[model samples]
Target: MTQQDIRKVRQEERVAELCAGVVRAFSGERDLHFRGRRLHRGRMPLPWFAPHLHPSPETDDFESFRGVADGLALRIAGSDATLHRTLQPEEPVERMLFEMLEQFRAEALVPEAMAGMRRNLRHRHEQWSLAFHHSGLTETARGLLLYAVAQICRARVSGEQVVEETEDMLEATRFALAPRIGHALGGLRRDRFDQAAYAVHALAIARTVATMLHEAGGDDEAPDARQNDTDDKRSVFSLVAEMDREIVEQHVSAQSGRSRLLEEAGAAYRVFTTEYDREHEAATLVRRELLAELRERLDRRIAAQGVNLARLARELRALLAVPERDGWDGGQEEGRIDGRRLARLVASPAERRLFRVEREEPLADCVVSFLIDCSGSMKEHAESVAMLVDVLARALEQAGVASEVLGFTTGAWNGGRAQRDWLRAGRPAHPGRLNERCHLVFKAAGTPWRRARAPMAALLRPELFREGIDGEAVDWACTRLRARSEERKLLLVISDGSPMDSATHLANDPHYLDHHLREVLARQEQQRDIAIAGIGVGLDLSPYYSHSHVLDLAASTGNAIFREVIGLMAGRHRH
Candidate 1:
């Protein structure tokens, strides 16, 4: 035998030793656990002491665990075969960790170059994983991220080496392939893969793992293939998992625990208000007494009894003084409100203080009725309807202008009956609480303007009066406002440009409510001081602009109707 044979035999022995190390590390056995490192498993990775330090599985050949472990293990196996001259281990885990590091060499794989790549890549991978695990990501997320880091070892699958993509890549790749694979298989059972059933596991490993990885930000950014692999131009999702994990550590969890709620990267922002109204309800022990006091004050404000104008004004002033928060800046957009250039806020001035007090009004005094169109035509614009109703309710509440909301819709198909009516008036505790109540208001008997006008007669023309310009919202507004108060009465009518069946509900149509609808419209041409506004939600409800008709009609696009509703209703000292 020659020196070549001796060297070949030595290399094989080294390979076996390296394989042994990987198997041990994965198994949670001795001489393998990295200091400060732990293997996480199950639904969410949580802390537990080292796997009870018990008897372990015997060391089968290095390839014995073949295909049983994921890519991390595969990379671990490949890296184990190239240590010593290839790389040096700083710890039990780093020895195995370098398997991936050596593979994605920054440059050519000349002997020295190959060796340096092993050291640098392993260091980067391990360091990254350590910091990531240190962050608050759940163990399940950590486990997936760690697994992806391990797979970095085999990023370049040279010459027919079996390599599974990182979990995120696998997930996205499987997505790209599963449909095609299914299409190709044409309904034959998804079974039989060279002697193993991997269809379910393969897809699970890719999609689910990738989602976990991407969510964790280990990343979804797909890397460019390292020379031998078939994949090119990595998907944004490839690094998405690692990216998620990294970003969480870098951007999110770095925040104090108070701010950590926003730490999750790429988190879906369903609700994003910085309010903690229910903080104490979640945990009994209180951390900040001020938070509790603030909460109590809020509850009082919501179900606020005996409207304290001075106290409320002071509260508003304090809130504005913070400068960190955002809210109504009567000082900023100073347009003429009620014939005066709007009163801008002036801190510490009696006039300003008095004015703020004046604006903080009584709920009963600031009454408004949002009469919305709920007829068939409203279905095409349900989104608009939702917006207007939401906006109106919120605006009224915000302005200290307590308002009741009522929707109407009379269906022609049902022998001229109201198909829906939703009406409710109560102090809403929060913005979302307002939204929930808005949903309930539309559950009653109601209809659109033309048809819904039929019910208005019941509220307006009760006694010797028969017909003519009698409707609920307008009549209610005028009659309610008649009480000698300085507060203006508001009637918000949201409808399409059309009027319904009421104009002809007369004797020739005696079967109807013995009142002429057209006569009623003519009578509306002579009202006063009833603050009227018409909001057309995604429709042309633009027949307003006079004392008789609503004087204001704003075309609110998208969900702006609600914001506009608040803007329209926010008290401007209407007399």
Candidate 2:
């Protein structure tokens, strides 16, 4: 690489490291990797862990990342051990109440954990309230009420009155919805703000409003309303559009006004678009007999390294063992005598040499997946990747870990809108490429490595190799991995270099595919159970994979590949 390129790579890595550090602070997780500006807490309901709050560009500052972290921590804690379960109300009023209480609860919990969080939380509440002040949506009304209740709770807990308007608004809402408010108030003691009681009160008010709306219409009205339902639908769409505009404005207003170095880098790896039209055709299952023949051939190649494979299996089996074990409390067995407890043994002669250390075999609870880049550039390397995958799969299976081998590449080259016209007009001079994207599934995690032999051998076919799209492939691999019931999962990508798809790259910016790959890796790494690493073929993949190894299969041959593959998987298995 040139000096300028080297410097650029270092700068990108440094920024990415900084972003990861920010995520670790908020998530209480250390092993997370970075992709663009998006942080990941894998296995979360909200998968992407960005610095800013959702739909708010104003909160996109580095400082706001901390607030998001605090919120995430509160959420995790709430999910784990909170006194109240998240309510599920079927009624609109009940739903509103449930939502308000949940929001109030989150704000209340933040201050208890972090003192400084109170100021930020209050500022955020004020921002939301102001932004939605003129929004006429029922959801916004529920949100405003939530803010009012939160202010009251804050005053009670901190012994300081906040803005008087909040108090005024709460009193007004309470009086306006008195009967409904009474149901909620009846549950609370006159003294303090009880979380459940306030939640009940909000639900009652919602129920009352819903009843009023319902009572306003009848059977005759239903038939008449259906007659003009199309008009009503148009009005609903118009309302939705207005709400969307308000949300967009809120995001724009909150947008950070600082340097966007991190954002720029993240943009480099973003998934601009996704194509799924070619999946069914791209993932062609190999014929049974052909698959069997290929597996037999690979088996012979794998059998050549019987000694090394056996040793690896033994080491892995031992490494995957449980950390602790227990022995018989009192029994006659072949074991070491408890010399330190000799006095006790002397008092109880029958207990002599009774204690023994017991060992339990570890469960084979691991899944390994190989994602190969099948772009045309990787044709020569595909054979090597296939061999490596077969050998690794056999070894892992022998070691009792589940394994799958998959491949990703695009179906068409340089096929876009311009190419579409040429093909539709009878392929005059140039035609659009057929089938835009392709993702191959050589083997599934649940399938035995032996059963996947033919499909694995299909990797040798040059015709199938096209343009590679790494991000979507990684995502697809992760989706499959997530379905497995393994405690530990490992995804290894074998690629020539960074993600490249001419159809996409030319259509948008050059770095789009690369950014998406980084994002996919970031998300997969956040999943505590899943570990992702890469083995680049004749190229360095370090820019994308945190744990990556560069290997030249042309020079290394069988033993070298086997050794490196074992080394990579061993590190994962041990941990």
Candidate 3:
């Protein structure tokens, strides 16, 4: 790594440690940790405060960070999560207002002795207000209204002056909202210390703001409506609002039932046919020249990511290694008596103790298999998936652990020969799997990564992607891993979505394949012979695997992604 890059990493680590200390001290939650710029309370993420947690490196100032930390600490210690949830509004604009108001209320309660904390809070708010204004958000009708309300609410609750920079810009908006929420604002200032009493006024103000925005008839798109469609910058309020929606959506998706069939008594999972199943070396499926070109491109991308492979290998070795007695230590100590040390003890005449003890060292006697989900939807993420698994395989090899890169997909779209056979059999009810299974070996465990680089790049071949049958693929990987003599076995599945087979869903039930995948994971988990974990490519795979992590490859650096995957394999994230 370059000196600059190394310095940047160390800075981030220090900031993370500071933030973690703040969280634990304020929230009294010892398990809360900052991972990849997000605060995670164990497996669950506290995403609402992510923006504050990420301080800009260019403007690195501890006072600003202290402000952010103190604000979050107060929010956690003073606010009631359950009460906030009960009083939260449903409308997006209203919800945003409600949350922002609650945060200010908590910040308003800073202890009288903490004058520095109060100054920090005000500075942070002023900075956020200036950033929002300078981003052109104040030019839009909806954004101006939200910003004006936030400034007014914070000032009212904390008894501080409004930010002078935006005072003239917000005059008209402040006047327009005064009549609708003036009474609620008064109540907010009056009951700032009482959460229950404060929520009533907060909710009232939130509903008023939402109602006013709706009446303006542009609340939905006004924030970014004027910006170029291709522009990636987003207002902080909108980003936090979007995060709220995503959390709700993920929860809903996780709760959606797909195991009805599996829950039924005496229900058995069966396959329609296995005659069309096929396994092949991935290198054979592509042209040599194309494979070499893909490999060069992949190598370039990985190099650009600047991942420290040696560090990753060391961490993996520490996590996966097993203890073994490599040698003996002979000395005059409290261990087994050593015959070789007897002569020295006799000569010394004062050395009464001579002992030899076995020394145990960590040995990487582990095997890991990366099973990629080569489905039609995953085509968009093929390059990233390939790069991730390739880097991981190389690192595992360097750690003295065997690794395999494998993939699974269907032989054809919908179903191939398997569906035809089912049709010939009169379409029997509850046909478990109606798709033809195809497994590909990109690189075997015993092969060196340099030799298999070309074949591993075959993951970029679009033609190989089709449907995905995850259950059988998991079984296949587990069986292969079990056959190895390694003391530890790990299977990591990378997929963007759940198991999908059009023919299977049409022939039996919509959730037939989903249920089977769950069953297979459960059975394997029960066996406890091999460890299985999952990495979701911009999606959550918690419904299928007991240990799973959602990876946003686009937003995360390669090093962060690898660390997250290692954390999952080490069972740090368990759902």
Top candidate on TM-score is 3
Candidate 3: Cα lDDT at 377: 89
Residue range with the least summed lDDT across 10 consecutive positions in model 3:
247-256
Give me the displacement of residue 266 in model 1, in angstroms.
Answer: 70
- Model 3 local distance difference test score: 0.78
Model 2, stretches more than 4 Å misplaced? 1-307, 319-353, 416-435, 557-559, 570-575
lDDT of 3 by residue, 250-319 (tens): 3312222465666789988888788999999999999999999988988888998889999999998888
Which candidate do you rate higher for TM-score, 1 or 3?
Answer: 3
Output the TM-score of candidate 1: 0.24
List the candidate 1 regions with Cα displacement exceeding 4 Å. Answer: 1-365, 411-486, 502-525, 538-560, 566-575
Error (Å) of candidate 3 at residue 340 is 8.7
Candidate 3 to truth, TM:
0.59
Per-candidate count of clashing residue pairs (backbone under 3 Å) = 53, 10, 0
lDDT, candidate 1, 1-575, per-residue tens: 23343343233323433443554564444332111112222112222211111111222222322221222232333333323224333332332222223322211122343454344333333333443344333244434443443333223212111122224443543444344333422211232211122223223333433344334433333345232211311222232244333322421000111112122475221211113112111112223454345344433422322233344334323322222233333432233333232242243334332211113322334455665544444444444344334333443344444454454432122222111111122322211100011111321122233332222222111121112111333443345445535355566666543433342222112212112222222244345456665554322222121211111222323333233344445421110
Of models 2 and 3, which has the larger TM-score? 3
lDDT of 2 by residue, 1-575 (tens): 23344343334334445544554665566555433223343322233221113324333343344454444454444332233345446753334344444444444555455677666555544544444443543234434443444444444434546555445656765465544455454443332245555555545544555454333223324464543544433432332245434434432110112212224543333332244345532226455566567657656655554436676666666654344454334443456664566687768876656555555556677788888888888886665577777777877788888888888876567654344644566654211222356788888888886667667788776777878777778888888898888777788888866666665545444565666566667677776567787775644465566665556565454465567666666543111
With a 3 Å backbone cut-off (N, CA, C), the pairs that clash in candidate 2 are: 36-266, 57-254, 57-255, 58-254, 58-255, 184-201, 269-515, 269-516, 270-515, 291-454
The positional error of residue 53 in candidate 1, measured at the CA in angstroms, is: 95
